[model samples]
Target: MENVKDLNHKPLSVKQYAIVSSLLFGLFFGAGNLIFPVHLGQLSGAHWVVAMLGFLCTAVALPLLSVLAISVTRSKGVYDIGRPLGPAFALGFMILIHATIGPLFGTPRTATVSFTVGVQPLLPKNAVHLGLLVFSGLFFLAAFLCSYKQSNIMTSIGKLLNPLFLVLLFATFLLGFLSPMGHAASQTVTSAYVNGSFFNGFLQGYNTMDALSGLAFGVTVVTAVNEMGKTNPISNSKVTAKAGVFAVGTIGLIYVGLVWLGATSLGKFNVSPDGGVAFNQIMNYYLGGVGHAFLATLLTLACITTAIGLVGAFAQDFHKHFPKVSYKVWLGLMCLASFLTANFGLDQIIAWSTPMLMFLYPFAMVLILLSVTSPLFHRDPVVYAWTVVCTAVPAFLEMISSFPPVVSQSGFGKAVTTFQSNYLPFASAGMDWVVPALVGAILGVTFHLVLKAKRNGAVESEKED
Candidate 1:
């Protein structure tokens, strides 16, 4: 067998590895990253730690595994793992990821984060849209310029802004902790983190897209390492691991600190139970008008960086699939699509993302498990396909059942509600995919074993003949 280092031909030194991992971490921790954990802390109150750990597992662990999956399989792209879904499913997955990370999800999110954290502070309610339009226009232009030049603009920005953000964030924590809390009377919603703290945190982490962005970031890390003249598999994994450790560690520290700040602030601020509202309330309480203004600016800048990276990655994927489509055309299309979605506001974005995560995450997890244990299953494509289909069919049903009432008001919604209501598994949670997916996975493995046995028997009979 080839040694582990030989598994990947790319290698890098310790320092290079650290830099790449730090950059990866920085890339993942943008505007949303800053806000979500704080919101969790504020809402969870005493249960914050449990919630934080759950969030970290999905947010940090899943993303890290995505990298590990890619490295272990040495596959050309995401389709390799997702191939069991067939080409059409792969195409759909591409579209979904594009929508989620590029135009549909990530782009609008950038605009929304900018609006909430950055623009909302300085502008009046009516003027917020005007700010969004103007700021987004300028932001995308800058993104286009950076993308065109092919400079590591995001890396540079991350390196600079992450430190600045850390300083400001730490300042927020210190000020809040030191200042006497206004009153602990308004903490009416302290049980938000009670029962499903980790699971909720896991779902929340899905909003980051760091778990999915591993494919693109992997390219970045590998490119950097190759340029440094270290091209060994073991070295490459080490570098990736090192960078991941640094990034996650930084994010973990910030997440914990911010959550604590939010929990403490609950004593003073009568913020809404909603995540976005809580974030704004905390900013206003600490920074005064100036603090709000600073966060808004910072959020806009950070969101832009994320959007550019996402757009670049999606455009590259589009070009790969359809060579006939010019890069500029695809890029323009993605931007336009995102612009339309960005108008929906932050709350809407979060609402829509929920079901999508419920459906996709289980399959993504299964793919990782299968890829890692490829040798155990003897690299059987049939097993991959069967396992995926079984998991996917049920997951898809669950996704359909979890549709927001606002999006569709027809029989489909009624059917979904009816199914979820009657089904023992779906009675409580909005997510019904978990149990069915588990059932399907078990059936899938059993079917694979039977198929293997049948094939062996047929071979024995042929040998006798």
Candidate 2:
């Protein structure tokens, strides 16, 4: 195989870049992306604009920044971002990221969410489980088949599914605006969203989990960029960055539209258990029974495309690390795992995954921050270690605090939670790690400068001698 570095002798044309950008957008914008923003809008009520800003910060901004960070680091995957920490840590972190975004949580979610929003409504209540089983079986099968051809993924998702997905989403948005449901609701804002709508929206955005997925997705984007002949690291990074901007812009517009639809539906529909339910209500209100059918088609295509992208990315990363396993085998295993997990249903899967997301997201954000700012700190390993360690401490506590009552109410857990609340700034807001991370970065840079100065002085003394 030609080396990725050697492949970048030529740059991609504007059209090629656009194709890659569209592909990235499709991969990242899945069921969760659609549901979360709408849910936020519904809950925020009169405070929807502030909430939207918050949602965009974490949902759109963080993920876009992650892609940019990946470009700047010239990373092939999440492993590269963690490599400075140590090989063991890098491998472990990559495994966690890929697994979480793969069959374990993300991939399965595509099936379950689609089933809940798309298929369940058409069936009798008693038959929902069996229906989910049957539906998910077909869903994963399609995803497996689509993911089988790894090389053609960009063309498949970018050229085929992306355009169709956009048209459907745009049509829905246009209809929503043309016939909004009694304007934004005058209902009381939910208590959680009342005082700190922005913070609440930010937290809600974490449920989409795109930032972590972006790390894994970065490899796929880079591969597509390489195939377009922009292989050199610098050129690859530039193209990836440009493509990321375009992709995020597309995603942001869709998110705003979805949120608007949700906000408008507040007066007409009751608050839903989740975004899928809320979206279903909105579609039905606008299009009636035909709307359900339309949403079903849209959800299935959206979910399957997302599943294919995630499964392919996971398999590719694992195959690279463990070449003997083979990409096809990895893909098969992932699809099978996702199939079984999807049977647990969307709510269960989400409940089980939320704590883990909380634990991992801050760490991922810190790593991206460090990677993007590494040049200022001379890319020192100490800086990476310190920043990550500081960030991890609060993140770990936050995760422990989020555990189910059986664990979180235990004495040790209570103590940790108490300490966090007492001393950590923004602990109540679920952003306790921010200050510590900044402090770690400052300390790391200072230490690096001191070490460098000492080494330079020693070299000068030796030359004089």
Candidate 3:
């Protein structure tokens, strides 16, 4: 097969750029994208605006910046972004990231969340389990089939599915807003959001984990731009940035709308355990019986498209890194694994995913931040190494603190949390690594400067002698 990257190229037209942006948006928006924002709104209640700002920072901003980082750095994936640290470190980071966003957590979540929000509400109470099992099996099977052939079906399905979803979604929004159950600003805030709604919302954004995906799947966007004829790295980077802006901006608006819908719906419903529930409540309230079928179809299609992308990325990457394994074998294994995990239900899946996201998001954030700013530091390994090491220490502790109550409340967990609260700045806001990362970066830069000075002095002495 000819390399698309090597083809003769020209700049993309405006309409072509829109399609690329839509493809990026479709890949990045799925599962947690649908569940997290509404849930934040439910908790934020009267403080939803403040909460939305924070959510936008991490969920929308970081992910888009991650894509930009990839473009500017001319890197393919997280593995390339993290290469400043070391080959061993970069490879490990890439593996962990892909695994989290692959069969281990993210892919399974696509099935579970869709089932929760769409199909579960329509099923008889006792049939929830069987329904999920059947739905997930078919879901993964379809995704696997699409991915196994290394086809562009994900993009094709997304081009069709996303527009339909948007139309139905906008209709729901119009109905919800025109006849809101209650005004959102006057709603009561949940205990968690009462004091630090923005901070809490920021933490809630961690659930989306799109930053990691942005880094992992960035090359896909880059490749899309390349195929559109912007083959030069600089031109491709500019085009990718433009597409990322449009896509991320659109996703951000949708998130704000979802949050607003959730905040307004509180007059008619109680706080739900997940956004899937809030989504169900709103859909049912607006469209009544028909909404169930519509939601199921939209969500299932949305989720399956997401599943196809996740599976394809994981299988293709693993095959590249370990070529002894065929892409088809990797695809099959990922499907089986995701199929099993998805049966755990959406709530359980989200609950467990929290710990891992807690751990990995900090790394992703630091990497993206550093990658974007690498020119200032000349891409020093010392900077990446120190910042990562310091960040990892607290991130690991935060992971423990975020575990489900049963484990997180244990003696060991308490000790870890206590250490974090007592010592780490911003621990309570769920960003315990911020101060340390800054300090680490400072130290790394200082050390690098000192070494440079010493080497210069040595050269001067040799010349004088």
Candidate 4:
């Protein structure tokens, strides 16, 4: 019996890991992703190469690193990294993750993006907003049903649909590239890739929310593997790592493919600040009504799938915090909240979410960095606290500058303003927090090392005495 059991068990090979990780990574790639790079291409024109490099830095690298961090730690839960902060910090983190992925941003975006691509083109002159409201309501209603049940159907649909979405994207890009349209004259902008394209790209990637979502995703992946009756930590980590590699590869391919298509299409399209308008114009000219309709369907499906995933994630995390509240209740409440927000539209959702994302991003990134480097510091609470505090101070201060005063004009506001003037490096591209975070990390590690050495010295002295 023992021999039979031993023979049945096997480690996941590289290819298997790649396949599973690719699927998980695809979960992060949704419709909102298609617009930004295309707009950059139109704007950058000849400078598309540099702009793309910057964009890819965030869009690709951060997400891959997130997977690596999760795999390396072999954490059973996303909140495991927050052990230094105790339960309070973990609860807050859970709430933040849920809200960001749920009604606040991800869910509403589904309706908005879907409306713009799928429904708006076919609607009457005055029925645009009305159609958007009605369509979004029904869409969320369906998503609510799917998410409430935690159906495997949602997963199955996503697995099938993502490949189709890829096919459509390829076709759209091919058509745009082959045909001729009026081209915009390319112009270079000052400071555009001068202040470290990698950081800029990293910031842009933050907008995707993939790294934040990765926390929950790690648990989900681990649980799925564990369900296969694999209890060994080493074995679990191996499978998870393989999955991360696959996911990263898939994301890299999609980002590169779409960025290339957008850059090439820019030669025939005018440069515009509004990415949505630019995207629409490109589709209208190339594929006309049929193209627009196809885009709309894809957008709606993409957004809906993402919404279901986000809501489920939020419900799962919220349940972790308030054990009294059932998953169904939280899921329903989140769906209702998200549905209400969808009425506000996609641009509104994106606009409102920006300040929040900006505020939370530095903290979240610092957490990921801390988690990955935790081993070097022996998971010391002091290093975690000092490093996080150092990084957080600058991030919150920068948030004060970008966010409207009315939003921050309370107790938090006064502190934020003080930090901005005194602590933050406000001279540069609103990146006041970046340097401080790096400095804090260096100091944190140094302090940890010094403390370890002193403790060792004391032990030796005691032995001699």
Candidate 5:
């Protein structure tokens, strides 16, 4: 029984806490965080408030909870989250997470999004692809250079770029609100959001995938706390929690402002194809010609900082696993891969990434919840394994179902979808895993208690002998 109260050490002063909080916030606030809320606000229209609340549950609350879980468990990184399952599972899970947030999806997205919002609006329509090719080439070159030296990323992004980004973003929000853009459109709620705006917003937040990043970022946060002289587990955990509060508060305020901007743009601007377009429209309306330059600078800074962080984290992790490969080589490869994928365009990248997000988000949530509540179940591995297994099944099914109609209408896909729809509660709401996860957790706790009782009986019998 490691008592949390007994583990305390000296805490960080207010100034030290603020610096770490800004770093964590910068890490979590990036391209998707900016885009998703605006799109949700647009679609939610008059229901934006409800949608925003729902988004906060997963976007704001879950990531904050993830940071706390990391501190409480003293996890070194994302790998530690799955380590209780076994080495193979741990490695595989980590690889998937890194890949999802690195070259395969997240890293590419940053490039594509920056291009769409920052560069495309300025380019001639005929030269869009060529512009992307040239821009992404230069974009990734910068990211690779920055990420090559991971030590400087926090100081550069947190201390310099994040504040500038926040100021510009705050100005945009202030101007948009003060000038107004008519009330939210009276448009009928979109189909996905019609019945369950809250749930829809909850699922929409999954697109940000910050929860996964939070797990990966645990190492960064812990390292920062240790650097600040908070070495004990309880002190580290408390410091991390406090920093997480500040970070999420900043993130939450920005989200609300962005959502408001989107909601108000309803009748004033045409419904854009994606959030990036909507955001650009809002900026242009608020700041005129200066808005384009402002948006370009903001998007580039936001995307590059995030890209640097992801590339650095991915390269470092892989280099550790395959020591023969140098970190610099891994960083170069990741940046190159991301560059190529980014040319696929923002819309395509988002479409492809959604299914993967659907598959992984629930599993990430399950891990976070179990880790934070581990003490109640005596930190049993059986509990972790069962909960993960239960969550993974439905998550896999949902992923399959999210594929194109060509694939989803196929024999096996149809069968899986039917089974899920008929048997799983909340299947339609994209949360079919919830009940099963809860059930599995209950069973694991039962197993732990029974095993504990049996072990005590055996020990008592041996004493009698």
Candidate 6:
């Protein structure tokens, strides 16, 4: 029935489409996106290509899949994705997702990390706290100005910030490649990557944390497509998918380059503790004193675009569900919340948010997969409900296990971990949710079919009678 209403419209021109794609890229590719693939390259060494292939699946592919999931499902935002489960569940899902990806976690982390990596190193140790306060205040002020008008977000990020960033970044890549660090093929593979480079890279993608943002960002992408004049469901899906492909495909290429940069740098530097350090090393090796400024600028550009996209998305989605509160009010609230959190409570914020991320990621992944495949199951409530309940058990376990050591070392935490590790496949690895989700999907589909057949049989008997 929903399929019958897919009207037609002209698609966007090449330039318009490219802008939409750039908006998506600007929204999703933040500091973490830069960090993970480079770290993977360092670890995988000679196997960087193989590792990046798997990394692409979860990093580049998963987010694009989330965008398509929104498009295909005809969901206006994350709120609609879980609506099949029930309005109450859908509302809760929307709030949790928006909160997790909004002020409580991802948004503030961008500011916090940008400060720590780019600006803090320049400040005296005694002045670090004051520096964070000043930076985050200025950061949120800029974010608020950019996103206060929803229409400005795409232009500010896509038409302006993204192109400039690409220019600066590609210049770095060119310099690194042209000069001699050493070939990645000859670098020594770290032990974990020497064995299962692909799997390790797949796991590395989880660190980007873009999948959750992708689901949240459905609102922005769909809004941009709608503004571009393709409102029909079919056309909408097409534009969204194409934009996602361009955005994430470009990201995949960058990942290849970033990882390769890391692997080759091993020629001159030991494996660093994290990608931030490795990235700095690359920049310093090439540009010396000037590289620090370039890095700070890059981090600020990458992160602010992300902040603008997320703040706008949060406001738009919340306003959609609770219209009594205006969008601008919600936007201001998020900016204020994140600014204060970034400046004062960042460590605590991270501790709490890590567990929430672990908890929410599985649900987001399962919901996206199911929404994309719902046609096969006729969008049945049973399928959604059963899969969700089954998945919840392991997801909850994973969340508790990810709690900070003080919390995770509790008796209750140990009990949860013991149960998960003893029984669930890949439980210790934070991936056990996958198998249980599959089982739940199978169970839901089977029961749904059984009920359908019985109802059909009853109808046939009634007709004969």
C-alpha lDDT of all candidate models, in order: 0.66, 0.87, 0.84, 0.67, 0.84, 0.86
Best by TM-score: 2
lDDT comparing candidate 3 with the true structure:
0.84
The per-residue C-alpha lDDT of model 3 at residue 221 equals: 65
Residue-level lDDT of model 4, residues 1-465, one tens digit each, is: 112232227765554454355446545666667776666555555555666676776566666666667766767555765767677787677677668767888767767777876677788979988997788788878877876665442353345655676677777767755774533234432255444444454455666777777776666566555644455666676677666766666666666655555555555555566556667777777777776777786676566656766777677667766889998899889888988888887767876777777777777777777887777777787777777888776766666655655656777877666666665674245567777887887887788889999999999999999
Model 1's alpha-carbon lDDT is 0.66
TM-scores for every candidate against the unseen true structure: 0.85, 0.96, 0.94, 0.87, 0.94, 0.94
Candidate 5, 1-465: lDDT as tens digits: 234343335556777777888888888888888888999988888888889998999999999988878877778678888888888998998999998988989989888888889888888899999999999999899988876676676676678878888888878887887888867646445667777899999999998889998888777677666666667666777888888988998899999988877888886876677888898888888888888888988888888878877887788778878889999999899999999999988877888788899999998998998888877876689899878888888999999988777768899889989999999999988899999999988888888889999999999999999
Task: Report the alpha-carbon TM-score of model 3 versus the true structure.
Answer: 0.94
Compose the digit string of candidate 2's lDDT tens values, residues 61-95.
99998998898888888999999999999999999
Model 2 clashing-pair count: 1
Summarize candidate 1's per-residue lDDT along 275-339 as a digit string, tens digits: 55667777777777777776776576567657666666666668778989976677677777777
Candidate 3 ranges with C-alpha deviation above 4 Å: 1-6, 151-154, 454-465
Candidate 6 off by > 4 Å:
1-9, 194-196, 344-352
lDDT of 2 at 301: 76
lDDT of 3 at 297: 75
User: Model 6, poorest ten-residue lDDT window?
Assistant: 1-10
Model 2's C-alpha root-mean-square deviation from the true structure amounts to 1.8
In Å, residue 378's CA in model 6 sits off its true spot by: 1.5
Task: Measure candidate 6: CA RMSD.
Answer: 2.3
Error of 4 at 376 (Å): 1.7
Evaluated at residue 213, the lDDT of candidate 6 is: 86
- How far does residue 242 in candidate 6 sit from its true spot (Å)? 1.6
